[model samples]
Target chain A: MNVFVVGVGLIGGSFALDLKELNSNVIIHGIDINESHLQEAMELGVIDQKSSYENLSLADVVVISIPVNAANEVVPRVLDAVHEDAVVIDTGSTKAPLCELLVNHPKRRNFLAAHPIAGTEFSGPSAAHVGLYAGKTNIICEVEKTAFKLQERALKIFSDIGMRIRYMDPKSHDRHIAYVSHLSHISSFMLGKTVIEKERNERDIFDMAGSGFESTVRLAKSSPAMWTPIFQQNKENVLETLDEYISNLLLFKSYLEKDDFQAIFSAMESTNKIKEILNGIVVKPI
Target chain B: MNVFVVGVGLIGGSFALDLKELNSNVIIHGIDINESHLQEAMELGVIDQKSSYENLSLADVVVISIPVNAANEVVPRVLDAVHEDAVVIDTGSTKAPLCELLVNHPKRRNFLAAHPIAGTEFSGPSAAHVGLYAGKTNIICEVEKTAFKLQERALKIFSDIGMRIRYMDPKSHDRHIAYVSHLSHISSFMLGKTVIEKERNERDIFDMAGSGFESTVRLAKSSPAMWTPIFQQNKENVLETLDEYISNLLLFKSYLEKDDFQAIFSAMESTNKIKEILNGIVVKPI
Candidate 1:
């Protein structure tokens, strides 16, 4: 099978690595606007050949793993270029806009919208590695819109890469992901911003950052080029989550202001239930 | 050396383990209000014997690793019970109030106010480990107030456990910790609270919590009993940090509201500097 991967960065490069490991017969062709990333992916053997959208017709599968803003413009173009029998899948963080753009297209049945819920704080082809998607959750949105055979192929590929599939509407996927994933990145970035702004001495922060601070602020290291588009594309849901998060912070601040130790304790204690839920997210060791 | 450790929970129990490893000739005596913890500490060999305040005078060194609220009351009593040569070190998170309480005591020279910037989200004796303090930072506040011999003894013990010591005044310790440590806990707890409140289905949260979410909210699982007192004692500094943090959140929200992608990108880009600083915190493998 020939796989044409658009935007061959972290997600696409990782998928390429895992796909080849699953089936040696699989040949991955890379396409990216960035010439260096395409060269790196080829040098790293993430792809067997470099190809353009004009040659996408040769692919048995086309995976779009670009930034959401670029994905909105490119998904239709990829569908237009792929063969009728080829299955096109997108691995974008936000799904609603991409799904809406292709909902009524003639070749819509060939495209599947997927959000593979996995990644590291780092980005680019260099950060890509096999097993990134292993034992992770993948959300398939608007699955009913895809043809049966294409959906089956998508599921089989995900399973081969060790991902468990969950089905939901694109809107639902965006809404929930805003709270679970997107908001975390924003909060973490702002945390780093706040600390850096307030604590001028970088050495002091370095000296005092325990595992807790390191863990809490890890997401701040994420690529701005990749994330800015995500926040922009998922603006409404992200804003809603931010409002709730900000309000919670303010309420917590008020408790501190009133010296309401009991309220503060109760809030944290209630959130401790997250441990039980988090323990269930079994990430395969890298 | 006779070492007496009060409140044999995570910090105290781990200290006992590391202290024993560093000096096999040292004897650790455990005391706790909870009988179960006392018994468990002895059974785990975190302590060689059980002792009360009545026998504290026999201790050449006393380590008080209790919650900050309790330390306010118990630190003075521990000082009163110890001999002139004995050094009493309280490993509380906050330092200002505790230092104030012992400022004019006749045995002030015998007490050293220290905050070992080390801990995990989990608590209790079972969480204790031998290398918990290895490659960690220990902040000794008001070092000038401690007698020369006692200060040297405290530094030697911290160094033996593989911690680098930094000296700061009590007020500076409290202020800096509010930004670097306490603020992180609040942000993480509130993030957990916000998500749990919005995402009603526990299964959805469990399914979607990737490494990013897990890392960002890890501190939400910390012991409420332990953290509440620290926040209360450092109310002024914590409140000030919270205000600055909230204002930063609001500013970021404004950028999101206006669809200012450049501003959002730049904000996160600037905070990416934290990655460089965080890389310097070398956590030892236990």
Candidate 2:
């Protein structure tokens, strides 16, 4: 099997490594506009060779893992280059825009829209690892649009990487991810901004940041290059989640102002249910 | 040496274990308003014996690890019970109100306002473990007020627990923590609350919560009993931090609404500097 990976950065690079581990016959090809990333991926042995869109037809599988904005333009071109029996899939964070672009395409069945709910805050080819997707959730959107054999092959690849799969429509995928994933990045980025603006002394922040602060602010370290496009593509749902989040913060602030310790206590106690929900998530041990 | 811990919960219980690991001659006595916690500490071998406020005079060192509201009242009484040669230190998050309480006390020299900047979301004696303070920061406030001899004793204990110490005024301690610690907790709690309120399906939350969401919301699982008093005592600083955080969120929301992807990109890129600051934090590996 031949796999051609677009945007050979963290997700794509990691997919290359995991795929090679799953099948001895698998040959991975790297494709990235950034020449350095492609070179780094090859040096790191993440790919067996470098390939371009012109030769994408030779790939048994082509995975799109670029920033969502570029992905909007690139997914169609990759689909056009692939053969009828070949499968093309995306690991982008937002699905609706890309799904819309391919809705009426001639080779739409060759494409599968997937968002593997996995990643670290770090990026680049250097950040890729073999087990990055282990025990993580992989959301497949508009699965019924894909051909049956291609779906089976895609499922085999996801399973080989140790992912649990769920199916949802593109609209629902955008809404849910806006809450569960995209909003988290915004909250964390804003948190970092607020702290950096207020606490000018970086030494003070270093001395006082406990594990809780580190964990809460960890996502702020994520690459802006990858995330900005995701927020742009899913703006409506992201805005809705932000509205609810800001309102919740304001209500909690009012409780603080009123010195309503009871309300504050009850509010936090209610959110403690998140612990139970999080425990059920199959995230790999960090 | 005999150490009497006023609250045999997370902080106090963990401190007792670390202290015993440091000194073979050290004897720990558990004290808590809640009988189950006291009993649990004894069962967990976290303390040599169980004691009470009535027996506080027997302690050579009294560590007040209770909630801030309770600490303000309990510290004076514990100071009164102990001999002049003894030391009384607290591991509370807020320092200003407690420092104010002891400003004119007869035994002020024996009380050290210390906030060990370490903890996890879970609480109780069951959550206590040795090395919880290893490589973490311990903030000592109003150090000049502590008698020279007692200060040495308190420093020795903190050092024994593998902590790096920093001295600051109580006002500064509260203000710094309001940004680094208290605000993170509030953000996480509200994030959890907003998601839970919007996503009615628990299964969906379980399915979609990636490691980023888990990290951002981890502090929402913290005990309300422990945090409510910390926020209440540091209400002014907490409110100030909340105001800035909400303003930042509102600005980001406006950018999202306007579809200003460039501004959003720059904001996140700027905050990515937090990754450097966090890298300097010496968190002990779990």
Candidate 3:
């Protein structure tokens, strides 16, 4: 099977690696605007051959994993190039913009909007590894809009590689993801910002940090190139999550100011339910 | 050597476990108002005997690892009970209040205000483990107040168990830790609260959460009983950190509102320095 992995970075490269490891017949063709990433992907064995949009016609399955803005712009072109039987999957964090952009496209049936909820903070092909998506939830938006046969083939492949797919509409997907995924990145980034700002005054402040600080700020290390477009496309939903999050933090600060230890303790104790909720999803080491 | 571990839980129990493992001659006597913890600590072999305050005179070393509020109230009593030769080390998160409380105690020369910057979110005797302090930083406060002989005996044992100590004044330790440790717990607990509040409307929101959310929210699972008192004792410093942190969050929210992706991107880029800062510390699994 011919697998075309565009972007040739973390998500695309890891998917290709897992596909290749699972199916020996799969040949991955790497396509990235950045020649260096393509070169690195090939050297890492993340792809078998470096290819481009011109060769996308040979693709049995085309995986587009780029910045969300780029995916919004390039996915229609990818759908136009692939055969009617071929499935083009774009793994972008936001779904609404791309889905809306592709709504009137001729080959909308061939395009699948998938946001695989899995990743480490690192980026690029060197950061790619097999089993990145194993036991992780893959949110598939507007699956019914895609051809049933294409959905079956794509879902089978995802399931084979250890991903469990949950179907939802693009609108719900964007709004929900703004909370669980995008807001997490924002919270982490801001937490990092607050501490970095304080570091100017306190030279050894970081020395006092422990595992708690490390875990909370881990996502601040994510690739801004990829995340910038996400925050842009989903700006409205992202803004809403940030507002709610900031207000919640303000409430906590008020509790602290008033010396209401009971309220503070209750708030944390209730949130402790996240432990039970988190148990439902397996957490990989950050 | 006889070591009395008061309020034997995660910190106290782990210290005893490490002390016993490192110095086989040491016998740990567990003391807690909660007798079940003492029974469990004995079962876990975290302590050799279940004893109380009356037996503290026999202690060569006394570790007070209870909550901060409890530490402030009980530490002076522990110091009064222990012999001048017995070093009493309080491993509470906040240092200033307890140090101030023991400032005029005649046995102050035997008291060491230590805040070992090592822990996992889980609590209780079962969470106790050997090597919990290996490769972790321990911040000691008001070191000079303790006699040189007692300091040497305590620091040597901590070093033998693979802990690196950095001395800071009690006020600076409380303030810096508020920025690094206390604020981290607040951010996590509030993030968990924001998401859980939304969960009332969105049942499957957590399904979309990936390792990012898991890592950012990990500390929300920490013991509220342990944290409440820390916040109570360090109210002023914790409140200051929270104000700075909330302002930063609001600034990010404003950038998101105004469509300033560049500012947002630059903020995160600068904060990405936390990756380097965090690299200096070995992060244990949350």
Candidate 4:
């Protein structure tokens, strides 16, 4: 099987590597506008060949693994070039906008919209690894819209990469991911900003940042280029989630200011239930 | 040397274990208000003997490792009972209030107000482990108030346990800790609260939580009893930090709502500097 992957950065690069590792017969071609990333992907042996979009017509599979904004434009273009039998898939973070944009495409039946609930704060081709998708959930939106054979092909590929599949509407995917994924990125970035702005002393931040701070702020290191469009595409939902998040913080702060020890204690006590929720998720490093 | 540890939970239990691991001649006496924790501490052999308040005077050191509110009351009382040659220390998160309460104590010279920046999210004797303080910073505040001999004794113990020491005033310690530690707890607790309230389904939370959410929200599992007083005691600093944090989030939310991709992108781009600061701290599992 021949797979042509556009935007060979973290997710794309990892998918390329995993495909090669699992199926020796699979030949992977890398494509990226970032020349250095393409070179890095090839040099790192993430892909079998470096190719351009002009040759995407020959691919058995076409994966759009770019930023959400780029995916919005590029996925349709790739579909226009690929053969009728070729399967199309995307690993974009926000689903609704992309799904809405591609809803009426002539080859929409060949495209599968997916979000693998897996990632690290790190980016770039070098950050990619072979087992990135293993034991993680992959949400497929508008699955019924895709032709059965193409959907099966995508599912088989995901299964080979060791992912559990769950189906949902694009709208629902966007809403849930706002809370689960998007809100976390904003929370972490703002936390990093808060500490950096308030604690001007770099030495103090270094000396005092325990593992809790490290974990809490780790996502602040994510690529702004990749995330900017995700936040933009899922803007409304992300904003609502952020409002609720800020409100929660303000309420807790008031409890602290008023010396309402009982309220503060009970609030923290209630959140401890997250332990059980966390224990059930599969956590892996990037 | 004999060490009597009041409240042999996470912090105190670990200290006892480390002392025994380093010195065979060291005898540890365990004390806790919770009978189960005391029994578990004894079963784990964290101490040589389980003792009551009457035993406080027999020790060469009396370490108060209770909740912040309890430490304020208990440390003063423990100091009254300990031997003249003994060194007393408290490992509560907040120091300003405790230091103020004990500032004019007749035996203040025997009390070294120290805050060891070592802990996990989980609490109780079951969570204790050896070497929890290894290479971690131990902040000693108001050291000048401690008797020279007592300070010397405490430094030797900390050194033997493999800790790096830093000194600061209790007021400075509380302020910095509010940003680095207390605010993290509040952010995490609220992250958990907001997600739980929005999702309304624990199963969805378990399915969707990635490592980013888990890491950022890990501190939400911390013992409320341990954190409530820290917030109450350092209310001013916590409130200010919380206000700034909420403002940052709200600004980012507005950018998202307006689809201001550039503003959101730049905001996250700037906050990514936390990567460099967090590089200095060691992250240990709780």
Candidate 5:
């Protein structure tokens, strides 16, 4: 099996590692605009060879894991090059735009739009490791658009890697992800900004910060090159979520200003239901 | 040595566990308004006995781990009731108001205003565990006001439990914590609230939520009874941090509205420096 991974970074590199571990016959090919990432991934044994889109014709599986904006352009080109028998999947955060872009393509059946709900705040090939997708959820948007056999092929690989799959329409995928994924990233980034801005005055604030602060601000360390395009591609839904979040913050602030301890307490108490919802996620042990 | 813990919940119970482990001669006496908490703590061995203020005069150490508002009322009372040799330390989130309330007390020198920058989102006696304070910071405000011998006794226990200590004026502690600690809680609670409110329309939004969302919203699960008072006591600084955080969010929203991807990218890139800042704090492995 020829597994070709485009833009080999954290997501792509991890996928390559896992695939090779699953099958001794699998030969992994790495392609990235950043030549250093390909070299590093190869050094780390994440891939067997350095290759390009020109060589994608040899691929039995092509996985595109790049920034959402780049995925929009590169995915179609890769789809154009790959054989009809090959399964081409792009693992980007947003779905609706890319699904729409490829809807009219003749080889639309060869492509699968997937968002693996997994990552740390780190990036690049060095940050990649095996089992990254273990027990994690993967949202497959417009699954019906992909060919039946190709879907089966992708599903086989996904199952082998320990990922749980869910099917959803592209529009709903983007809207719901805006709340669960994108909004959290924005809130975390702004938190890092607000605290860094204050560190100019309080140099010791970091000393006072505990693991809780670290957990809350973890997303602030994500790659901007990857996330900026996501926030841009899903602008409408992201904006809606942001407005709602800001409104909630303002209401909490108003409660504080008025010294309405009861209201503030009630707001947090209601949100405490998130404890059970979060339990649905498989939290890896420390 | 007799150790009395008032409000035998997460912090207080954890302290009792670590203190008991430090010496076989140590006896932990639990005190709480809630009879069930005291019973539970005794059953869990988080406390060896159940006692009260009437028995506090026999205490060599008294750790107050309740809400800030309750701390303001109970800390001075404990100070008045304890022997001159007993070290009375109140571990609340806010420090300024508590320190101010005790500055003129007849037993002021026996009281220490210390905030342990440690805890999980869960509370109550069951959440208590040994080594909870290991490798975490404990902020000691107005340490100079504490009796030298009493301070030594408290420092001895802190060192035994592997806690790092830093001295800060109570006013500065409250102000800095508003940015790093209080603001993060409010942001997390709001993020949880925003996604939850949307869940009313899209019930499966949580299915798309991943560990990142879990990390960012973890603090939202904190007890309302605990945090409401922190916000109340530190209202001025919390409001200041809120204004700055909301402004940052609004500015990021404006960039999105105008499709200014460069600004968005740069904003996140600058904040990525928090990566280094966060690294300075020891991250426990997962």
Candidate 6:
């Protein structure tokens, strides 16, 4: 398979590496607006060679792994350029706007709006790894709109990369992901800001931070370029979840202020069910 | 050296294991209000045997490692019961209240208020490990009140357990800890609640959650019995920090609501300084 991956950062780079590993005959062509990332991805062996957008005509599969805002704009262009037989799929955090943009395209059946539910706080080609997608979910939104053959090929690629598949509409995918992924990023970024502003001593924070702090603040390290448009695209769901999250924090604060240990304890105990839920998934080693 | 440990749960049980590991001649006598924990501690080799408070007379060191409320209530009693030569130390999250309780005691000089900056979400004797304290800080508050000779013995035990020492006033420790440690627990617990409430399907959360979500919500699994009293004891500081945290979240939410891409990007970008702060801490391998 000759795979063309645009914006060869963490997700695209990792996909390129996996493609190379899975089949020696597979050739990965990399593309990125950032020249340094393209250089790094090539130097890191993430792709066979750099390719022009015009060359999408020769590709078997084309992955648009740019930021959500860029994906909505760029994926349609890639769809116009790609061969009729080429499958054009996007790996973006938000799916609705991108899905809506490509819904009326002539090659709409060639496009699959996908979100590979995997990544670390780290980014760029340097942060890519072969097994980044393993044991994680890959949500394919509005799969029925994709051509049957393209959908089958996309499923095979995901399965080969060790991801479980879930099907949902673009609207549900956007809403669910905003709660599960986008809100976590905002919560983490805000948490990081609070601690940094309140405690200026980086050394004190370094010494005192335990695993709990690391996990809560991990998403703070995510790229602003990648996340900003995600929040924008999924603004409604993000706002709703943020309201509930703040309300929960306020209620917890009131309980603490009143020295209401029973309320505090019960609330925490109820949330402790997360332990059972988390145990069912494969979390990265702490 | 003989050590008598009261409340043989997570911290005390781990201390016992480390003490026995450091010296073949060291014997750890356990005391717990929970008979099951005491039995499990002995069975798990965390302690040599169950012992009474009267055993404080025979111990060279007495470690009060119970819940924060209980620690404040019990440390003074143990100080009264211990031999004049025994060093009485309480490991609790909040120090000002515990220090206040011990200030007028007859053996006030023998009582040290310490908080070992180490713990896992797991509780009870079975959670104890021989190296749990290795490379962690053991913050001693109101240490000036401890006699030089008792301090010497206490220092040796902490050193044997492989903990670095830091000294602070009780009030200062409580204030700083409210920002660094207590706030993290609240953030994690509330995040868990917010997600669990909004996303009703536990299985979907389990399937979709990545390492970032796991880290942010990890502390939610902590024992409410242990955390509730700490929040109560340090209510003012915890509430103040929580208010700041919620305010920060609200500000970020406002940015998202307005679709202010640049502001959202810059806000998160500024918080990325945590990368430098968190990069230094060695997260214990799971």
Clashing pairs for predicted structure model 4, backbone only:
none
Q: List each candidate's DockQ score.
A: 0.83, 0.87, 0.83, 0.76, 0.85, 0.75
Residue A167 of model 1: what lDDT?
Answer: 90
- Relative to the real complex, the DockQ score for model 2 comes to 0.87
Q: Report the C-alpha lDDT of model 1 over A186-236, residue by residue, as the tens digit.
A: 999989888898877546646877889999999999989889999998999
- Regions more than 4 Å wrong, model 3: A283-286, B283-286
Q: Which 10-residue window of candidate 6 chain A scores lowest in summed lDDT? A: A201-210
Pairs of residues clashing in candidate 3: none
| lDDT: worst 10-residue window of model 5 chain B | B277-286
Which candidate gets the maximum lDDT versus the true structure? 5
lDDT of 6 at B83: 84
Runs with alpha carbons beyond 4 Å of true place in candidate 1:
A284-286, B201-203, B284-286
- List, residue by residue over B1-286, the lDDT tens digit for candidate 2: 9999999888999999998988999999999999998998999999999998888878889988888889988999999999889999988999999899788999999999888988889788998899998898899998999999999988987777789999889898899899999999999999999999988654665588888999999999998988999999999999999999999999999998888889999999999999888888848643
Ranking by lDDT: 5, 2, 1, 3, 4, 6
What DockQ would you assign to candidate 3?
Answer: 0.83
Quote the positional error of residue A13 for candidate 4 in Å.
1.4
* Per-residue lDDT of candidate 3, residues B164-282 (tens digit): 88999999888888888888898898888888898767666788888899999999999999999989988999888888888898888888888999998898888888878888876
Candidate 1: which docking quality band?
Answer: high
TM-scores for the candidates: 0.97, 0.98, 0.98, 0.97, 0.98, 0.97
Query: Stretches of candidate 2 above 4 Å error?
Result: A284-286, B284-286
State how far residue B65 of model 5 sits from its true place (Å). Answer: 0.4
What lDDT would candidate 1 get against the real structure?
Answer: 0.90
Each model's lDDT comes to 0.90, 0.91, 0.88, 0.86, 0.92, 0.86
- Candidate 3 per-residue lDDT, tens place, A1-286, comes to 9999988888999999999999999999999989999999989999999988998889889999999888877898888888879999999999999999989999999989999988779999999998888888889998889999999889999989888789989998998888888888988988888888887776567878999999999999998888888999999988888889889888888888888889999999999989989997765432
Pick the winner on DockQ between candidates 2 and 6: 2
| Stretch of 10 with least lDDT, candidate 3 chain B | B277-286
Give one digit per residue, the lDDT tens place, for model 6 in A54-110: 888988999888888888779989999988888998998888998888778999999
